[model samples]
Target: MTDRKLLLRVTLGWFLLLILAYLNHFQNGFHFDDSHTITYNTAIRNIKNVPAFFSDPTMFSANPQHHHLRPWVTTTLAVDYWLGGGLYPFFFHLSTFLVHIGLCLLLFSVYKEITGNALQHRWAPWIALFAAGVFGMHTAVAETINYVISRSDVWSTFFIVLSLFLFIRFPAKRKYGLYILAAVAGVFAKETVPVLLVLLFFYILFFEKNLSVAQLFTARHFKTVLGVVGRLLPLLLAVAIVQIYTLTRVNTETQDAGLSNPLISYWLTQTYVWFRYFITFFWPFHLSADTDLKVISDVSNWRIIVGVLFVMALLVSIVKTSARKETRPISFGLIWFAASLLPTSLLPFSEVMNDHRMYFAFTGLALAIVYAAGLLVIRRESSVVAHPSYKKAIIFAMALIIGLHAFGVHQRNKVWFTEETLWKDVTEKSPENGRGWMNYGLSLMSRGDYVSALKMFEKANTLLTDYSFLNINMAIANAGLKRNEEAVANFARAIMLAPNDYNSYAYYARYLVEQQKFAPAKEMAEKALSLNKNDIISLESAMAAYQGLQQWDKLKQTASYTLSIDPENTKAANYLAAAHQQKATVALPSSGLKTSEDYINLSLVLYNAGAYEDCIAACRNALALKPDNADAYNNICAAYNMLKQWDKAKEACKKALELNPNHANAPANLKWAENERL
Candidate 1:
């Protein structure tokens, strides 16, 4: 093939690999791990969420808590809600793929630009094509690119690349107005992309030496200033609108996972995480949804090594490149990678090594890799005259490395197909990864596979055994198997591990209620309650323990409090009503409440008790509350059937069908009622 065709062929090869990534992922639905991004994520499921999402930073908080709130990332999902309805995950993956490709293209452009003069543009396209393809298909990006929830990384990187590309070209054209506006557009997509400012500053200092960072920030001397401003006006408008919307509507409601340690603890933790990151980037075999990495509370022995190496890498890249001047761009790219990583490296973020953290930083690593390889190739070829054999060998070596990377990427993509597979694969690959085992255990527990989960937790305990959550999950698994003693043991162990907000106390206390050990259960439950009174699950368990112990007054108070916390929970309300009934002078709140749902559920709960009158009464209340409640209407028909009121049953059944023809219970009840009418 001609050189142009050859470059096209190579680009096609990389594109083919990208296709494989999508193909591997396409059949896989959004796993339960990332399910909230579509279903429960308040921000992304609807446009109504937009006003709330922008208003609450805590609502969109993407930290290690209830979830990494990703408002900007999930806002796209909200848009997807209208565009495709139930096919949100499908479109979500599609958008992510396009964004990934866009990012790859930008990375390629950067490499191609940096090395353009190296081979007179002959090698630029191939290098760019290879870099983009490699970055796109690399397994290291599976967490950020393939996993649905990690779209924060994808969203952030998309803007980062766009901003960087626009800024890079701005210098060559000296039309700052248009591209700077583009960079600002990027900042809206993710706060992380603003770090591009430092990257841009580095690129100019190391690569584009003619332009200073301050000069690029302001360019009044540009000939096309007015024209540039005009070209950029629309982008400027869009960014300003998003900013205004964010400021006006947004709240700091994005919840973060609480951290006990100070910021310095996070910084110290990054030493270990940074080392782990380097190891994983070079060897992308095992990955986890969560890794149980230990924090270095103190700067001690091994951490000193990690900390020193990190410092050396940063200083060397900065000093060595600036000294040579010729090697400055590579230095800039290296420093950019390290600098971009700093925010996550424990400076501000509590996370040590978020895969998304690598999104922009990895480009620097890739650039450094390509630049180093290019330099090595040129230096070696300078002394040796190339023969046919040498040219073939060079191509073969490049192909081998690329082929190996592709195989690894392909293998890694499979692990991301499900959470269990991902954690299992991570633990297997990263045997020393304590967090990997903990996550794998949790994934196993999710499926009710507690036996296997216990083993995984034990392994994690052996690794980062001091942590409390491992004990909590292990206790949960024990409770699932009805191993009460083991469950209690694990729960107590967890409480001892941290002495704070213990899930173990809650679990053991619930098991104690099941065993009729109310006294101990009440004591433990109260402690758990004191830690988090609003925890619905624990509150329900605690109230049950009180009810079983015949602490009627206490039960009434606790159950009422639980209902207040979660007004939608009929059980809590039911418990409170029962507690009130015990006092002969006070009548219980009607078993059914204002909700059609409450009436329907009350009817079901009473159906087995031969309480046909009460069931019918509850169904009537439900119908009265929600005239079109299909389930209530259907159940009313069922209640009538029990009472042998066939004509009334048939009539009520018809109303149910009219309201919800496809209602599961309605159809079954309708068939039964019709058979009776016949």
Candidate 2:
């Protein structure tokens, strides 16, 4: 086959393999950071807000603590929201997957250039393809791909690779500043793009200057070293300018700098994290969304010692390989891997290590490993000059490795299929992660498994006593189980912990609305809106409060505003219609319980407040006003069940059924009473 045709066929094959490997992940739900950055982030709900994303760093996340200046990330998320017409995971995943494919293709061009420069062999393009395939299909990359919001990592890495490709493939374009523009664009997606400077310097040192890694330090090559730095001056200046601009635009106060660990201990823990990253590149197993690894306080700890030894060995290998032209790519690749990790390692993050952190570093490891394997094949070919079958054997082995990685990617996609599956996997793999346990409890609570959810929340509270989000979730779980006092206490604790967070107020408002406490609910909802006016959850809570308080004008105004933000909101439309009709009706005082429906509503409020005796009294009043009222009988049965009067509960449920056989709550209440009686 002609060389161009061969490249086309190989490229097509690589694309096909990528699709097959990641097909299962396209529909995978958003996980972890997606909640703050995409789902709850009201800024991305409208496409017109995209411009503000560049000017306002707080638009990046609903949670103030997570705010950062990743305008490109936010812009892309907003576009995805517009394309999908809502928070659809598929479009978000597709965008990330497409960027990943672009990165892999760019890596092929980059790897081919580096490989050809190092080996001057006919198999350079094919070897580059193999390397790119290994990276594109690697199980480690799936951790980033399956996570929708981690698209920031994917896009930044793509631009970095594009800059490198342009620098190598089109030297004439350097004067036009194409590569510099690409690097600058990458900075908007992520702050780590400046690491590209280190990568380029080493590329020039090994490939352009033809110098060994040790020669740069020798006196003989001092001028050559200066020349290399001179060549990089323009790019370095551009990066510095872009970084300064980024710093000015970002909100420094709320940025999550990952300072959870003390500096010395965080640095110590990173040594072990490096070892784990290195091994996973080769083995790619036992990955977790959240890891249970803790910082090492002692320098003499066995894991830290092992980690230090691994780093020493890696440096030695890089230095040894840099001495030979044919092995320079290996040295360069190793340096790329190490440098890619520098940003995350030097700065402590909440997580000491994360699986998605491998996406960028593994790009370099893939090149090193594939090039090393190519060397072995060349040696074997020379020893057995006519052994054509050995070529097939190498192909088969590579194909098998890719196949296993593809299988692992598919399995990991399954783990990310739903909130419940994802958090369940986290709890299993990262059992000591209090956040993981709390997230799993949230998924359970979402599914109405409050009893099991509370158990998980209790475990999380033991581990993370002062976590505000955990306390909020504990409050919700307690409310689901009708533990009113505990729920109220937990809500108070959550608000105390995070007074500035709108989530605490919004959730508390929702719970108050459920309890018919419209006055407090409206106050809390307005407070939440003062913090984040675009929040739909808070808006809905305000609408509920207005409707309950018979404030037709306020209800109509709030619902219309909600509809403007979320045009497809059926609840808001219904509330607005209800407000229009109810405007002419006279509002009733809360103390005036003159009707059966009013007494039934009061009974529900009492039951939600855990006032079971009061609930029963209200239900009795409802029955007296409207004899044979099935709802009143059902309310009496529910209150009796809560009071553990099983016999009385069963009798009320039976009466409710006789009054109206189709009553919804009577059957469930009777079943519960019977089960508890047994």
User: Which lDDT values do the candidates have, in the order given?
Assistant: 0.65, 0.86
lDDT per residue for candidate 2 within 1-678, as digits (tens), equals 897798788678768877988898878887788988988786787788878887788888877667788899999999998788677888999999889988998999999999999887777888898999999999989999998888888999999999999999997778988999999999999988989999999998899889999999999999999998999899999988877887787666656565777887888888889999989988877799988888889999999999889889999999999999999999999999999999989887778999999999999999998999888787677754677677677778888988899899989999989989988998998899999999999899999999999999999988898999898999999999999999999999999998888889999999999999999999999999887776778999999999999998898788767755554454665566567566423232234345678768766755765657756866776776699899998999998998999999999999999999998779999999999999
* Clash pairs for candidate 2: 258-349
TM-score of 1: 0.65
Best by lDDT: 2
Across 579-630, the per-residue lDDT of candidate 1 in tens digits comes to 6554213232454254567667767755654556656766775776577788
How many clashing pairs does model 2 include? Answer: 1
Residue 559 of model 2: what lDDT? 71
Candidate 2 structure, TM-score to reference: 0.83
Q: CA lDDT of 41 in candidate 2? A: 81
Clashes of each: 22, 1
